[model samples]
Target chain A: DVKVTQSSRYLVKRTGEKVFLECVQDMDHENMFWYRQDPGLGLRLIYFSYDVKMKEKGDIPEGYSVSREKKERFSLILESASTNQTSMYLCASTQIGTGRTEAFFGQGTRLTVV
Target chain B: AQRVTQPEKLLSVFKGAPVELKCNYSYSGSPELFWYVQYSRQRLQLLLRHISRESIKGFTADLNKGETSFHLKKPFAQEEDSAMYYCAHHPTQGGSEKLVFGKGTKLTVNP
Candidate 1:
């Protein structure tokens, strides 16, 4: 089974505190993604990595960053957590191919900022 | 830029009735569309994609390029089908490989 596992399902952080959300896929997918899901905004892409050490910004990459040091792992970093950053973060991984290929997602990390 | 839009924020339908979850996308070029579902307390997973034209759990979606839409449909709605549904679109190739998603619709199938 292709499984994408997150480091934490729930996280609590204070304002200005640095936070890290980790995701790993056993499927060896070459592409990984980080997205923050909001109530009415859907899932906004924060960042995505097509290869190890290669990262690019997504639609909503203003307050987020990502790392792909290993092919199976992708990490999302919040330089400084803020109240607005409190949202459901989802991590996904997929093989490179046509746009039709599907991306497998983890359970998700619900972050609460205070 | 590729974008997806799910017009309905919520949809309520009775069990055994037909269900349709609308999805519209905007892309500067040709696009690939997908439907993903998240059951209550369950992880999100892909339900179907436009290109493959496959059906899972009796749900099927036909991509209409002319309308720039890919709508998910089920002949007989099941109570279990009540969940959050999202429509996603991604580019054919290149940098980021980011999948753009719509706000999603909360589907409620009441028996």
Candidate 2:
């Protein structure tokens, strides 16, 4: 079975502290994405990496960054955690190709910033 | 700008009743559309895609170019169908790999 594992299922952080969310996929997918799932707002893309070390900003990448130093691992970083940043973060991976393919998602990390 | 829109935020229906979760997209060219579902405490997963033209778990979606919509429908909704549904779109030509998602609709199938 294809799996996308997130480091933490829940996390609490203090204001202005740095936070890191890690994700690993065993599917060997080339495209990986970070999305924030909020009530009514839906799943908003934060960042995505299509290749190793290459990243692209999504609609909501202002307070977040991503790293894809290796093929299997993608990490989301919050430079300064704030109350407004408290939300459910989801990681997903898909094969890179012209045709549309299924995206495998992680269990998600619920982050609470105070 | 390319965008996906799910007009309804919440929908409720009795078990065995028909259900439709609306999805609309704003894009210039023909884009790939998809419906994703998230059950309670479960990860987000692909329920169906427009290109496939196949039904899964009794759910189906058709892409209407004139309407610019891809609504997901099921003839009879089961209690298990209660979940969050998100509509997504991907550009077919552009090298960009971003998949844009709509605000999503939460369906409740009450027993």
Candidate 3:
């Protein structure tokens, strides 16, 4: 089974603290994405990486950053956490292809900024 | 800007009744659409894709470029079908391979 594993299922952090949400994919997928899901805003993309060391900003990447030092690992980083940054974060990975392919998502990390 | 819209935030229906969750997109170029479902205590998974043209779990979605929509439909709804459904669109020309998802619709199939 293709598995996407998240480091933490739940996390709580204080304001102005640095945070990192780790994600790992067993499958050798070239495309990995990080999204923050909110009640009314849905899953808004924060960042996506097509290959190792290559990252692209998404619609809502203002308060977030990503690191893909290795192929199997993708990490989302918050330089300074705030109360507004509290949300459910999802990580997904997919192969690069022309045909329609579905992404495999992790269990998700629900972060709470205090 | 490419955007996928699910107008209904919630939809409720009785079991064995027909169900349709609407999805519309606003992309200038061709789009690859998909339907993802998140069941209770489960992660989101792909239910169906437009290019496949195949039905999964008795659900099918037909992409209409003219109407700019790809609505998911099932003839008979089951209680198991109750879940959160999201409509997503991917730009064909973009190499990012990122999907833009809608706000999602919570489907409730009452017994």
Candidate 4:
């Protein structure tokens, strides 16, 4: 069984605070992604890293950033959190491939901003 | 642009009743489609895909290129089927690993 571990299950942060959510996949997948899931908006991508030190911005990447120092670890950083930025954060990983491949996901981190 | 669409936000049906969850897509190029389910208190997982033409847990989905749709179906619904179902797309950009997901449809199966 593949394991994608998230650093936190639930987190509380104040407005304008800095927050960091971590994800580590045991499979050493080359592709890692960060997504923010909201009720009606679905899962919007924040950022993704296909290789160490490489990052690409997603549709909703204005308030977020990501770090990939190693193959298995990907970190999502909120430079300055806001109430609107609070959401259920999901991390996923997949082996780099040209053909169809399934992504494995972590349990998710539900962040609350007050 | 590549996109996935799940028109219904919720669907309710009785156990043993036939169930269908609709999914549509708009992609300029040939794309792959996927149906993902997230059961209550459980992580989201892949339920089926159009490419493999396989049924999972009695559920199956078909890709209609002319209509640009991939709809999920089950001959009989079950209470354990209640969950958030997300339709996803992998654009013909081919190597794009980031999948564009739909808003999701919440299925509730009654006893």
The TM-score leader among the candidates is 2
> Which lDDT tens digits does candidate 4 get at residues A8-81?
99999999998999999998789998998899888899999889998889989998889999999999999999
DockQ of 3: 0.65
Query: Where's the lowest-lDDT run of ten residues in candidate 1 chain B?
Result: B90-99
After the best TM-score superposition of candidate 4, give how far the Cα of residue B70 lies from its true spot, in angstroms.
0.5
Q: What C-alpha RMSD separates each model from the true structure?
A: 1.5, 1.1, 1.3, 1.3
Model number with the top lDDT: 2
List candidate 2 stretches off by more than 4 Å: none
Report the C-alpha lDDT of model 2 over B1-111, residue by residue, as the tens digit.
778999999999999999999998998777789999999999999999899999999999999999999999999999999999999886577588888899999999999
Candidate 4 displacement at residue A48 in angstroms = 0.9
- iRMS per model, in Å, is 1.4, 1.4, 1.7, 1.8
Supply the TM-score of chain A against the true chain A for every candidate structure.
0.96, 0.97, 0.96, 0.96
Looking at model 1, residue A36 earns an lDDT score of: 87
Residue-by-residue lDDT tens digits, candidate 3, A1-114: 649999999999999999999999999999899999887777999999999999999998998899999999999999999999999999998888623778899999999999
Q: What does candidate 4 score in Cα RMSD to the true structure? A: 1.3
> How would the candidate models be sorted by lDDT, starting from the highest?
2, 3, 1, 4
Number of clashes found in candidate 2 = 0
Candidate 2 lDDT tens digits, A1-114: 749999999999999999999999998899999999999999999999999999999999999999999999999999999999999999998888634888889999999998
The better candidate by DockQ, 2 or 3, is 2
Docking class of 4: medium
- Model 1 error, position A48 (Å): 0.5
State which candidate has the highest DockQ. 1
